[model samples]
Target: GGSASSGQVSRGGGGSCAFGGMGGGGRGVYAPTHVRSPLSPQQVTAEIKRAQSVVEVLRVHKRFRSAFNYIHLSATWNVLGRLAARAPAWLQQHAASAGALREDTHRLLCELDAQGLSNVAHGMAKARVTSRDMWAASW
Candidate 1:
């Protein structure tokens, strides 16, 4: 048995200390070994453009599976959203015509539906159609 003040439990020949006891045993704080640098405006724009192009190609092919990996598309969209959230005013203004991004997302949804990937499509549909301004507001 252990006393609250002593924070020690005796069993057999050994004793174990509780939290805040003489000996401490708790989870260590998380610290990243490498810190990622923020992307430049140009880089963000380039990534958005690249994702747009890929989606365009997929739409033209009418097959998202062959042209794009689901995980990759998801990750790219995530990155784009994060970048957009931090975009400057000038970049936000440029992102106003996020029509293409919306269109591509719709096309992906259609492709997923056609492929009977309803579960994945449903999950993806929850993600808002990203516009540069939308991302900026998210922050």
Candidate 2:
């Protein structure tokens, strides 16, 4: 076991996070700066749309996977298609996340309208995601 450094603070719950020293003649205690509000579904959808790389897409997906509505889910699928088209090699290394996204999409299939399902199918084709479960669910 190592000793906690001056810049390290235990944030309770048995975890310690490293924090920069407090300057400006202030106490060296850690403060919660810039706490993020959760992004709304529309905001998340927009984020998915604006993602330029596989890593960005996966990061957003992992962050908001359980919060996605059908619209957000559809948008994620579409962006994944674009990502696949733009960077097939880079996307290959993230097959696990892709598979998890597939599972999430699969669970929400019934919520998608015809056009949403169409977009999903089109995206899957573009991304070459030939999962039998996915194809069968779209039927």
Candidate 3:
């Protein structure tokens, strides 16, 4: 424990636990923290549209590897899932077609699989389906 008072057993064998020497209070462990604000419906839609545009550009250039690396398609699907979970009903109703999104995700996975990144491809594939299911169930 970071604090002198912490980790000391009381008369009744009771003591408080401090996390990662935090209670000692002197220059305790410092780690950077990330705070993400929720995306507005417009922001979410714009991001999805951006991802779609990247996919199209990759297709045009036949740059599958760059697409995989630069676009982080797996993360895009994750963001989409989060949007589905948090988007308002009106937004969801007006959102892009789920089937098209699923198809695009499958296409990306197939490209990754062709490049011998089957592990990443499989993981993204599962994530796509899981997110879709979660979105559906949320409705």
Clashes of each: 0, 0, 4
Per-residue lDDT value at 118 in model 2: 75
Model 3, C-alpha of 61: deviation from truth (Å): 17
Can you write out model 3's per-residue Cα lDDT over 67-105, one digit (the tens) per residue?
222124444544444433333342234334444443444
Write model 1 residue lDDT over 1-139, tens digit each, in one string: 1122232222222222222112211111111222332544344334434644333322322322223322234444554444433342323344433444434343332222122233333322333332433433321
For model 3, the run of ten residues with the poorest summed lDDT: 8-17
lDDT of each: 0.32, 0.61, 0.34
lDDT agreement of model 2 with the native? 0.61
In model 1, what are the clashing residue pairs, if there are any?
A: none
Q: Which stretches of candidate 2 lie over 4 Å from their true place?
A: 1-37, 89-91, 131-139
Most accurate candidate by lDDT: 2
TM-score per candidate, in order? 0.28, 0.64, 0.28
Worst 10 residues of 2 by lDDT: 17-26
- Model 3, residue 12: what's the lDDT? 14
